[model samples]
Target: MYAILGEDKSDVATLKVILKRLIGDDSIKIKTKGYNGCAELLRKGAKQITAFSKLGLAIFVVCYDSDGKDPAKRYSDVVSKIIKPTGLKNTICVVIPVQELEAWILADIQSVTNVFSSWKPKEINNPESIDNPKEYLEKLSRDCNRRPRYNHATHNEKIAPYLDLDKLKCKCPSFLPLVTLAENHDAHVAK
Candidate 1:
């Protein structure tokens, strides 16, 4: 079983969609715990570790938009204060700063906009004026591909400029374990 702790319901839904696509809905159990912010999620995640450990479950914590803070420091804090003390390694934490679970979905921007309709910015008031942030982003992505130099910024740059890319880069390696684990689990069931 896998449990995902996120900043909000939307983040959890996005993660659930990805997890279902990658590992199959039946093979993994997904649950959402809301937190005011990354720090709070870390706090709750610590407690979750104990309960999950008892159930012999694997837990994955994914947080977004860490507000320019060092993800490694945050992760280490959780591990040292919560996970390690509990002696749990089956649990893995992956943080995606600036946008949470939305970053992982393979869908184009428009798809994302549809999922987060309520949160769409009113600045794009014109019904046809790139009203959907996701759609706007998808267009930008397509344009970037057409003109390579137009890639002055990466996807994260366009969607979430506030993120500390340096910190995100440092913690990205942590996600490999979960990705590999999910892939392996999928392969086993397929066979």
Candidate 2:
């Protein structure tokens, strides 16, 4: 079994979906340690690591965007504070900075404004300008091809773009390796 540790519920959900799609099994247990923060999770994850090590289960830690901090730095911190002291070599850590998880959930207008203060919506000089912001964002997302620039738009921006999640999955540094590992495991079992 693999363990996924992250700051948001959406990351857990997204990872679970991806794992299920790749491995053809939804039985992989995915637990969310905390919401929007990792300090406490890191502490509890330490205990979980020891237990998993005893069971000899392969353990992997996944974290995302420590804001502007380097992923290696964050991984080192988690290892030192949680994994290293536990003396577990079966465990490995993967971190994604400027995490896609955040973008997935906060793919809306108000959320975008909260992150990028300079954002503004393009003024639609029509009666439809009164449409629900969420609906507007959704339509805009579909029309703009889901680019990060759309979702991360400021309040002043009228349209939020869409990102090609499929394309992104392929490009994510951590994604291919995980998929390959799962595929190799399946292949070995078949042999």
Number of the predicted model whose lDDT against the real structure is largest = 2
Candidate 1 lDDT over 128-181, as tens digits, reads: 122333445555556544333212123322333232223323334433444565
Lowest lDDT block of 10, candidate 1: 121-130
Candidate 2 per-residue lDDT, tens place, 60-152, comes to 656654554565677677767777767766636455543344333233233344434454444232211233433455566557554444432
Off by over 4 Å in 1: 62-64, 98-107, 113-178, 186-191
Q: Tell me the TM-score of each prediction against the true structure.
A: 0.54, 0.54
Model 1 TM-score on a 0 to 1 scale: 0.54
Count of backbone collisions in candidate 2: 19
Task: Quantify all predictions' global Cα lDDT against the true fold.
Answer: 0.48, 0.50
lDDT of 2 at 69: 53
lDDT of 2: 0.50
